[model samples]
Target chain A: MDELNREAESAPLIKFFTKLQPLAPAVIELCEAHTYRVKIKKNALLVCPEAVCSECLFFIIKGAVRGFILDDDKDITVWLTDENNLIGNFRNPGIPKMNYKEHMQALEDTELLVLPYDLIDQLYAKFPETNVIGRKLLAIHYHISQERSILSRIPSAEARYKQFKETHPLLHFRVPVKFLASYLGMRIETLSRLRKKSKQENNLIG
Target chain B: MDELNREAESAPLIKFFTKLQPLAPAVIELCEAHTYRVKIKKNALLVCPEAVCSECLFFIIKGAVRGFILDDDKDITVWLTDENNLIGNFRNPGIPKMNYKEHMQALEDTELLVLPYDLIDQLYAKFPETNVIGRKLLAIHYHISQERSILSRIPSAEARYKQFKETHPLLHFRVPVKFLASYLGMRIETLSRLRKKSKQENNLIG
Candidate 1:
């Protein structure tokens, strides 16, 4: 049963890689060879502050993770990730030196495909097409970050909330309210009021 | 004299690409082949809001550029780039359908090597090693963006100013104070006062 569960979990990751479409066969083979399957328990810290990030990229097979920073007695959520998402410090590929600006924790019992940075370097050396995949993926992530940065500059909190909802509709269901509130840069009270108001309006529309 | 000046300007770009130690020789050749030299007058917009960004990447050979947005009748500077920097909407690689969230303008008469997005795609298909270069470059840019996001969360404008100066010392001389003030999320008066206070403190230390 355990073996069967593992196979079932890893299936999604295979699908994810296959969907990239443009990735060369050798690059795909490199991914399959290098990636290791790992299971993390609920609330386990995947990444912590004050240390260089582990030279690994994680592909979520199942479960959710939250990235946050402890700021002046407050935990500010920066990002949330779940199944089918890739998470890692994609910043410093050389020397693998990156001070952990955020803490990443598994929100539930999580299954992940962990690919070491060295493997990626090897692929870069051997399979140049991997770089193209890397560029496309990074470009998508950059776009998202740029969009978020733009949205944050808007003066209205309500507008920001709406934008967030529009962009990440699934997050509201998966993430804890407190963490979601923090991610949105709003007080819990405001989040609660917004949720209540939105629910009531939804009911009226229904 | 004009031809000599062009050669001198493009020399730096060749040096920059050569420094990417891991890049294969063929990949470098691809870069050389695809890159187009262009000149822009001071204050000319490179990117504009709501338009699909041009399918190109720019390597600055000379002068500076600023990325900004208009918010409530005020221009908010989001980023500044100078010599030896790469600038582009690294968000979209195909179809070039990226709505510009910020306006990018040449702050001075600028020389750039513009590589069309299609050329990169071609390199990915032909050279393969170009993928590694693309990945490494994108990773570096992503890292910088992540660092900025972390810095922006800090509450103190003074602290942000110090951090900005520490990270981008050269920008102080190149960027206009008004734009820099906006980028740091502070008023011009506040920035001026902070600058004066810091200068006085530096003199005392000196």
Candidate 2:
């Protein structure tokens, strides 16, 4: 990549880091040096279910990605993310006796900044400020994972759809209905019916 | 508590910490100073549904705890943990504008070492080795949360129950059928029937 284009590519991540905390320029420079940008085509597998767990952290600069698993030979969406968010294996690669069986795929042509786990460890050691951002990022994903867990346990299909809409205002529309249904632990037909019923209610209100 | 009794109580946590990574004596002493043990009676609420998000992590030394939420006026179990594990708000307390709504209750008389968030931050600042342990713990919980999310999205009730049993062999026998059913996202009757069927199959195989 050209120097100017590389600088432009790193802008979003720089903005994200500063939004988390104001850091010294040196720390940002270090991060910039350690990270690289990549673009993934739609439906491209970033992490395959059969492959070893992903070892790098991904910061989505543009487009979207999702994590899903195969259950009884059917695809079940468990995670969805878009621009300005982080994605990758939830498992710590250093931890032994753990299995990571999820697949990560691009929903759209996606741009991402990749930071390897080794660089992350270095950042933690070299810069105290890195820890805050690390903790915050982990917390954000941890919260999302917990909410998804809670959402899946909800009994009513309509209620689950409503809560999902409320929580993921943009995601409900971005992904396919089949994926949305699988994520909500319901069939596509059920999601379609609920959407139709909801639209009718909105029309009446209007 | 007497000094000897305190030492005995701290032994389990010390062992857990060392199992993650060897730390300096001073670091262990710092952690010991910041933590205190508590015992919760069975059925008592450790973190109530109506209360604010729990601010302290409970490192369970004995017995069991379950995290649940009220959905459509019904208690739906989302998290269940036992001895030698940590439980608390999955959301970072420092993260603004996030709501935690789960209820944490002791399923049996539970012994725990409570580590408040402030002290956790202090430890992070004081001991470099603390970061490894912290990351490992978060990774463990994040993996669990992801698995739970995936479990809830499984279309087959029998498959969900079987996976849950395999993941938590001891827990299935320890908790009541109703809670287990809710955690597995199925009706109590459904779980009971599945259990009965599994038992018959096991007998046949035997």
Candidate 3:
């Protein structure tokens, strides 16, 4: 984490600074200088529920983050955004009642690119480069969510886990089993059994 | 439908072109003067799999369209972008496997604001307003997909329908019962029963 994200912490936009996308050099420098980098230790709260969502976007420069809701006394993991992906709440539908999302939490110690939601809105209003990246990122997120829905529809637990592993090999490696289980819409025990079955199959094949 | 959407068939952006979010006058005029109107008969296909996605976007000036894929011999409605919501596949992901979506079809005879995808991308690259709206539109779509995930997680069918009705009342009225049932992760019979129960409960309360 330290090696991958050393100067990444000093200039939060450093991860994106060297890269050429839709943003201009001056604007990129300005962002690199202005944006803040913050660290959250494992199990730390990044964004609490009903907190007005002041800064609605984040990036995992290093480590991982979890988005979950407390429904019927169960903490359900909704999304696990890491690496270059953006994490945020839905600004439309005007928020929801019974909003218990503990959005943006550190699954491991994490470095973040924190931008004010309104400023990002302004950037989208001001920059075309940002807009292309923004749309593509949203497209990526939409694809992930849709795949999860498709997985949930499939009845077999092993099949669901297999699909998830095939779709997100990085997630299975980086994230904890519990988080992976929930994200796949399955119970921990079911995931455990599936993993064991999969291991045996691999061993036999080998 | 005709009375409710007088401009639907003729104006491509009538549904979501807000004065509050206006484009440059020159751009707006360019759009209005050159933009062709599309009136698709019921079940008309807008874009199909294996076809290059050249259509920039269609604003439902009137009527409805569904974006879906055939998965395991079933048509899965991934999106139902209605009036005021933009629809197009500017970036279709198909590197691993080519076909992802089957086609977007007019649920009824529809009027659409037709902007070629290339023109919008070019304009979006040059203009801030186009980029802002494009990103904003993607944000909404992403949010809806997340909401759909949350709805699917509800253990009870009734609770899922309640959440759907509360969050997207528009879909209940505009979308076909079958699609609504599918989106809600329930059977058509179940949704019908839920609607009936909801109506009776409302009547009693009133």
Model 2 segments more than 4 A misplaced: A1-3, A47-54, A93-100, B47-54, B90-100
TM-scores of all predicted structures: 0.80, 0.90, 0.79
Residues A19-47 of candidate 1 have per-residue lDDT tens digits of 55455666655566656678899989885
| Cα-based lDDT at residue B150, candidate 1 | 55
- For model 2, residues A40-142, the per-residue Cα lDDT tens digits are 8998988422232237778898888888887656787888878888788755523432233788888889888887776777887888567667766666677
Ranked by TM-score, top first: 2, 1, 3
Docking class of 3: acceptable
Residue pairs that clash (backbone atoms under 3 angstroms), model 2: none
In the range B26-131, model 3's lDDT, one tens digit per residue, is 6665455445666888888885222433455666777888776665677766556566656766463312212355368888888776777655666666665675
**Lowest lDDT 10-mer window, candidate 1 chain B?**
B92-101
Error of 2 at A186 (Å): 0.6
Residue B200 alpha-carbon offset, candidate 1, angstroms: 4.0
For candidate 3, give the DockQ: 0.36
**lDDT, residue B73, model 3:** 70
lDDT of 2: 0.78
* Model 2 lDDT per residue over B1-206, tens place: 66566567678888887887787888777667667778889999985222322476778999999999887678899988788887887546344322447789999988888777767778788785576677666776777778788888889999889888887889879998888898988988999999999999999999
